[model samples]
Target: MTAHLSRRSLLGLVGAGAGAYLLSGCSGDDESSDPNAPQTINWWHIQNTEPMLPVWAAMAQEYRTAHSNVTIEIQPLENEAFKTKLTTATQAGSPPDLFQSWGGGVLRQQVDAGLVKDLTDDVQPWIGSLLPAALQPYTIDGRIYGIPFDVGMVGFWYNKDLFAKAGVTETPTTWAGVLDTVRKIKAAGIVPIALAGKDKWPAHNYWAYLAMRIGGLSALQQAAETKNFDTPDFVAAGERLKELVDLQPFQRGFLGAEYGSPDGQAATMGNGGAAMELMGQWAPSVQASSSTSKKGIGDKLGFFPFPVVDGGKGAGSEAFGGGNGFAIGKDAPASTVDFLASLLTVDNQRKAAQTGAVLPTVREAASGISDPNNKIVAENLASATGFQLYLDQAYPPAVGQQVNDSVAELIAGTKSPAQIVKDITTVAKSQ
Candidate 1:
């Protein structure tokens, strides 16, 4: 339905720019008038791995072939490295022409600093081609600032064989049922959950989802606006998490586990060392790649949305996850915007989806998905009644990091649920 909207209707949703930046070789004027202008667009993205790495490179080459005078520079960096480099560049007032952005409070900070472009008018023509729900992460204060290439939600990726071995009949739909499932799996001599505790982010997912389920989707946004996380709902969320921790559900030495390493979370799940994991759409591919067999546990894998909590405010249909996208830097050439639009064409998006590396943001490109697990995630995301971006990406850097720290402490039994909320509130208010 979103793919058929007219440009006029889409343009009505665009918001005005907040401010302007003055940079050498950059102008607010339209440069499309000069068709032969030599332009080079600098792009930094995190698809440094095999499938997506080559896919993005091929797309750039195709674009270059069509426009002889234009040059597209691509720098593929690992996730953490990309974030560090981008931070330094932004602080130095020299951001890449186009760079990877998750688009939430961080983008809002950049927008306020006038380091990014206002793409309201530039993208309106084809913006409607993307699923409107996928656009929420990029829409800041009613204005668009980024273009999403992929979208998905967090859920349970489990081994069907392992479940049956544990005599678990149904996938869980409530908190109590999830605990029961974990207990059964542990009794069957299988680690219940594979978590990348050393990474901190993976462990934080549990607390974030619990908060969403207990307080409702709006709770985080309300806390962000008021700079207060010290509340009954938030503490209750942590308490619920503590109940899971009490079962010792994670793999042995999980606190030191990495996400993609041979002995880490995905590999553990892929090699059938663990019964399940709570992860995003990319989990399956990562699992396969990290496993010793390099083929993962193919048909043994299954997916289900995060289970609900009885008497909680959140619904089963609300989702919590974020995807990858590109943000326009302030000094980028005018042609940079056009290049970004070109990258999102249905054909290009389909190629990305075919790799099983991404869940396409373009509505029509959804058909390109070859894996059933990914298809299930896409369908659930499409039907979601509410959505929330990853908390680390949705909040300021300091506030986000504080959340990870506090939650980690809570998981380690070093802090109480109430203390964790207080720690988070102290950091959040300072931000």
Candidate 2:
């Protein structure tokens, strides 16, 4: 109960300033009691792409300069690769000292398995400086398990020039309008969307947003609790996504495309080969890094909230996404937390924000976000009426993967709308 915000109120303090909501909990030996000690911190993160990759390295080097006692070994892995490797590592009961964490069901499972470090005492003193809203995802059962550095929601990252060329005058605000927009864009001989089907997870955003719009935030919570996703709402969400899929909206050979590959989703958008892609805050930076010119589409990139679904229970104001954080592993030296704290400092947060690739979790660094696209996302997130962490990060790993698998098959035309729900439900029930 100390976490304060449950899954239902993840964004309760988004626009408000509040004290840190993480309260006291059971304890472990205070590893951070020592001021200086020779230690090697093993860090694994998924900001392997440029812009962020260099930014993270710079931060580590800065930390090292401040404390010569630490030798930090860094590994920047690709998203899918990080997930696969992390799973294997955790199963083997060996987790990196500091590793990237999305902080929801996965963190909870880690906590339950005693694989994660209890950071309640380690983080509370300085946690108040960060956004209370951002902390909710990392808090489980009255203890702090991780600390978020970036927070944002999923939305459409579109190429304005392509939209204009397609003669779509405005961004769609309804599901029907989005379909119409796609049709128009496609007819104009432009790929309506740049999708990374080989990655599977990118395609899942469409279905997740659709379900959020049609079923409401409560429906997702209910399904998670009941382990049943066969409801009419979910089925309709799938069918609606199918309507867009059948329009042949994505780039050619999209099903075989990778997300950060040279010819993949971000690059396609950056190269002006597509009108849009559903993604989170980092889209623009990734686009720039993956693009041929390494400058991306620059100001041509724009963002919009996922469109509303008419007659659906969810409001357009609700957001679906998650942010990035670092969790300490069970056996990490106490200096690990001190090092983590150093990275989350307001000055460091401001530094990260100025790169325009991150949305600051520490309130003081909010002014550092100068990228207009990121600002748009930040404003929308601040005013979000509700929030849903990405489902893959919200549910148990197995259940979450099932959602990605089933939705990807639906997008690939290998699974029916009804069958995808049945399959997801089967996995959920088993879990």
Candidate 3:
């Protein structure tokens, strides 16, 4: 069930009908030099951090100024709550004008439910301009549906200073090596890794990271789309996960820690209470903004690709990620659509990237970024052959809830891998 979109074929479509318009027949008020000409777009997103909150607010203000008639009413929601409200709103036929979405299971489910708009025409001409990894999830059954805003990879983020203290000369490149490295780090009196299991999604991500290494990218996709947990491929992934858990690689009380924000937990690394963390590329942003900003530890951060699981079928470079993007709602006015399209243009996307958000969606924009770490992350995301969407976003909301519960149980040693897989498969099969 893997979907394919070759660069050449996508380029040909762009050339043949590049001028077709999705904005046609859409109308808005004609007034002064205003981009916001009285259009009200209810935009829902969960960006509640000092760095990003102000950044997005400023962007919204700029957007409103350009379109005098348009105003994006920002509705901030918690991650778990947002999903619930989104479902209720769509079911009630009164969803927001534009909402934030992470491509993968969530976007797929929304599109399948007819809760989102298709942007095939608007996306065609700019199709080739995007990196392959940034475009795949938006396409379903050969139709493009949304635009990417932030695209990033999951990786190992380590503290160079901590590594030095532990007497580790180099980062590990294989799962076996990582385990050995973890043992040494712990024996040296430092937390090997910091994990926030309270956030179910991060817990699931740990499993997905291991699954991709255990089953390979294609096999993971097959199991997901086909709901075939009986395959030895997926079973092996579960076993590997159990093995990692058996090692007790995480900090004490990690199973109950919250992860949606970096506020309180990042102090572990800020104070050298922990050595490293395996998370999205955006993780550095948290460390950079930590209480130790005055201590200069931010500059000492290092990143590595997720370690390969030895003897596994997966590629060493394979990654798991989700693209954050904008989508037009069914009721959005034509002018609003125009503003959205223009906002995501190369120039604006470049600013977004520079301002600390990932922007691989627009190659021209990504090229302008000066941050070396971000640049490396952006490049890896671009060259990615395939992506594993965030598990919560990929499955039905109920199934996602089950996944969270399963991971919690597994981590708590209350549920066996076989039982967890069976529980998830039972619900996944229904979907």
Candidate 4:
């Protein structure tokens, strides 16, 4: 979940610097003793997974072995912490040699400030093999700036056990059916859906997906960029969410819920207090990380793309979510960039897929992975007529925060659909 930190807080975290940033996967290998060897390259990433770490570790080790001169220091900062650290490091002129970013506004800021290297020339050969949308977020004007890695979609996850108990056998495929199913699940004494509202970020996704399924992708893109949020199309999307809020599909007091910790709606799902969760393909990883919960959950968990709205303008199967990628800093050594480029090779992507549950941006590397969940997500993403980057990633940070806060208020009953549309428009125009 993305948290809105004050600029001061972000600055403080970033200023904490080397001690905080160097702890992720830094090793004590002393291969730097050779005076003629190239300098060590530091990589700042936010990935810390029990199952996925080994793949990255081996990748780094292999790169080092091949380059001999480039010793890459892989630092794994917590997601939120990484953002703060990155902001500070860049400001201090001590940023990592390469960094992992969602690569829209975040990287754009770095590019605008002349901190990131333009990789248009470097990334071209691999660009042809990537899905076009995966490259959209990282592209500025006409130049490519990052190497695509993990690509996935966001959708709905339901509890098969809860559905069975509610006497619902088939997954609903229409907007009205979604409401009816949630009502039935609630009547069976469970929270119809788990919402991480306090996190604000997850709640923001509700709007993104709603715009996709109800207002259509074009409408979503318009609201994402301009003061056009008050359009009939956008208001219609906001109304759908308002109807859900009135029906109580979300848990009681959900607006007060926290995420990225034990107190979130994800916890509620794990404990069976909720019947469904609306999240990305990464939901499986969350379940997999908890041993007891994983065993107890069994095959009861199921996933489906967001339901289509009757007569909606959008294609039903088009999905919304962003992927991760590797970006090079302006000061990165030539060898460091080469090593990072190799990690995106088909062979390494397939290997990474085995440890990490990522869908390779390259079609060939994706074919090498046999994980069922990965296959389902990859197929859905590939088949999607269009894809929406994460809502926050699609807009400027200030506008994204306003949208997030607006959604939280909408869910909390403090704002009306019309008001939200008006408010978002006012915010967009100011930016």
RMSD of each: 8.4, 8.7, 9.4, 5.8
Per-residue C-alpha lDDT of model 1 across residues 1-431, encoded as one tens digit per residue: 01111111000011111111112232224334354576777888776654566677778777777876666767766565677788899999889989999898888888988999989888999999998877887888889999999988899999999999999989999999999999999999989999878767777888999999999988998999999999998999999999999999999998887776668888899899999999888888778766788778999999999989999999989999988899999988767888899889999999999988789899889889999888889889878999999998999978887898888888888999999999999998888
- Give one digit per residue, the lDDT tens place, for model 2 in 1-431: 21121111011111111222111121233445454656667788776544555566677777777776666777766667678889999999999889999999999999999999989987879998989889889999988999999999999999999999999999999999999999999889999999989878888899999999999999999999999999999999999999999899999999998777778888798888999999988888777766788788999889999999999999999999989999999988767898899989988898888877789999999989999999999999999999999999999999999999999999989999999999999999998
Give lDDT tens digits, candidate 4, residues 102-172.
77776777788888888888767667877777888899988887877887888777788999999889998
Q: lDDT tens digits, residues 154-217, model 3?
A: 7877888889898999999998888888888888888888777776666777777777887888
Q: So what's the TM-score on candidate 3?
A: 0.85
Model 4 spans > 4 angstroms off = 1-37, 90-95, 251-253, 294-296
Q: How accurate is candidate 2 locally (lDDT)?
A: 0.84
Instruction: Give TM per candidate.
Output: 0.90, 0.92, 0.85, 0.85
Residue-level error in angstroms, candidate 4, position 62: 2.8
What lDDT score goes with residue 276 in model 3? Answer: 81
* Count of clashes in candidate 1: 0
Task: Note the Cα lDDT for every prediction shown.
Answer: 0.82, 0.84, 0.66, 0.70
User: Worst lDDT window (10 residues) for model 3?
Assistant: 7-16
Stretches off by above 4 angstroms in model 2 are 1-35
User: Highest lDDT: which candidate?
Assistant: 2
Reference-based TM-score, model 4: 0.85
